[model samples]
Target: MATLNGSPVGLADMQALALTNYGHFTTMVVEDGAVRGLALHLDRLVGDCRTVFGAELDPEWVRECVRREVSGCAGRRTVRVTVFCPGLDLTAPDLEARPCVLVTTRPTGGVAGPLRVQRRTYHRDAPTVKHVALYGQIRLRRAARLAGFDDVLFAGADGLVSEGCTWNIGFVDAAGSVVWPEADVLPGVTMRLLRSAHGRHVTAPVTDGLLRSMRAAFATNTAIGVQSVAAVDDVVFRTDDPVVTALREAYAGVPLERL
Candidate 1:
């Protein structure tokens, strides 16, 4: 079942959200009532609400809402929290614009296999906030899927790779140092957690030539912690690389917090 601010979401609310897609959201998997980087998720919600709605959202209220939704869940569960304004960004004569929180849950399983991503030249508008408007990116990914690729990795007009449709991409050089693309991309929560565990990493222009030359590559997101990339448009990578293995282990070692 889906919920909104500790209450059930109905057809009217869903219909309203479809009109004005001006909101920020975050999604993460909660396992056995524990979450990784819980504080960071809360911070993202509060900060993004302030930026998008010109108002402050209480982190405690968010947690309480989430707790009420998933209070009795037994296994891995997915939670999506969104903050949006009512009345389609315009308040009525007696109404004022206030950000509303929406929470929903579903059962989640393990991560998928290594992804085979196709390169697409695309860029996100804001790149930082996890907003609601994403049909453009989703459309690109759908087209890539229809063509046999597992997902799409966005590139810039300058030929620099940024990130994936729903994840952050990373590469390892011959020396075994993790290299992230130095471009505008969403900084995923799992990406941040992995970076903290990975001692040190570098960022550079991830050009197509660089993608072809990298020793190994992987994708990171809340849905998939650190998944090896089998190929990036015919340029193959070693899924069993030692760097990828170590990262997977480090990510598994990250402690979880009660949700």
Candidate 2:
């Protein structure tokens, strides 16, 4: 029961669909009609889908479907494709393979700058999946904008930092160690890759001093590969710090795969 570009898509239209109890979406950058990081994005999409849905999915099929769809696109463009569940019980076999909605090839707004951050208390269910249930994030963004900030950082009732409304939060210590909150935050794809390659440590309940020395801070999501953090609550850091530069380069060098 998925619709692509307002048209109903048949089962034969795709090789596979990743379903989850919570909604999910994906963003891709396309140039010359070719999608970048198709394999990596699909791998993550399938993996998250399986984890949230509590079932296994075919990786090869997902890859082929994305390939088929993107290959049909016509010209240089930046595309974002999103798939969401229609609030049905994901445990059902039929619903497991059918996404409620599918959107593709929309324009990316613009490159965001150093975000002005406002702290708030908000939590989400199934934080790992890229779901469409983003009311909290939407509200937080509007609040941030009205408050003259670019984004919002959520904290738990325990006075510990959770994450940004739309991105993972990272901090650097005076000792040059890159730190992030523990598993409470979404296991961001960029964070996972960076942690795997760099072996950085994840700390619990981020702090102010630690956030300040952030020598370099950035956020990673599907659309923006790695965006630098310029200022947080009027506190600014050197955007070109070696640690930040190295991470940006390392992330760029890792070849994207479809697995």
Candidate 3:
């Protein structure tokens, strides 16, 4: 289901996104009228709206739109809240910005994980914001899948690991500390939630050379809360890692906020 500002989305409303594709979005897992890190997701929407549209977004209104879309959903739902200017013009893009909220929901079941990912050197435009310009990520992910991998792990030209195609990458060191790569990737809500709940994480530079010193790796996102990484190219990590188990538990234990 899709809605624009609590109303049904129409073809005209989607034209701007298809033509310009200038917007920011946050995806979250909504279950039983509650969400983990709901505040973070809302904050991301508000901040990214200001960055992309030079306007303000009401988080409470966004929440209400989301609630309207998923009010009667059963089981689990994946909700995407996109902030965009539906009337945006490419030639005269500086017109007074009027950002609109587009909310969409889809039924979600089990999470796929223990991913075998391949490393690729690439970066995204406006890496700090979760924007809709995802050509680079989609291209690299497709290439990785065609090359016999489940997904792509992105790194910089300097060989420092950053993140996955659509998730944040985390490592478990020998000392069982959670290691987040210090890169210009998007600050994922799931990553932030895990860091707060686990309380034993550090931000550091992660490179291919440092993978040997790490014990295990995992992927964090709204869909798959914490998924083990079986391999990153030739380097394989233990899927039954205890640290990963603890992380999953910790993520599950985080209190859910009601909408």
Task: Specify the highest-lDDT model's number.
Answer: 3
Off by over 4 Å in 2: 1-22, 30-40, 51-56, 72-103, 108-110, 198-204
Candidate 1 per-residue lDDT, tens place, 1-259, comes to 7777788888888777877677889998888888988999999999888777768899999888889888888888889998876565434422455777889887776788989999998989889988988998999999999999999999999999999999999999988999999998888898899889965699999888888889999999887888999999999999999999999899989999887
Q: Which pairs of residues collide in candidate 1?
A: none
167-248: candidate 2 lDDT, tens digit per residue: 8877665666777876477766677677766646667556665565556666666566567777777678666667766776
- C-alpha-based local distance difference test score of model 3: 0.91
Arrange candidates by lDDT, descending.
Answer: 3, 1, 2
> C-alpha displacement of 11 in model 1, angstroms?
2.4
Write the residue-wise lDDT of candidate 3 on 1-259 in tens digits.
Answer: 8999999999988987889888889999998989999999999999998898889999999999999999878677889999988778688788888999999887776878699999999988889999999999999999999999999999999999999999999999999888999999999999999888875889899977888688899999999999999999999999998989998999999998998
Clashing pairs in 2: 23-131, 24-130, 24-131, 39-257, 39-258, 40-257, 116-150
- The Cα local distance difference test for each model comes to 0.87, 0.63, 0.91
Q: What is the Å distance of residue 181 in model 2 from its true position? A: 1.6
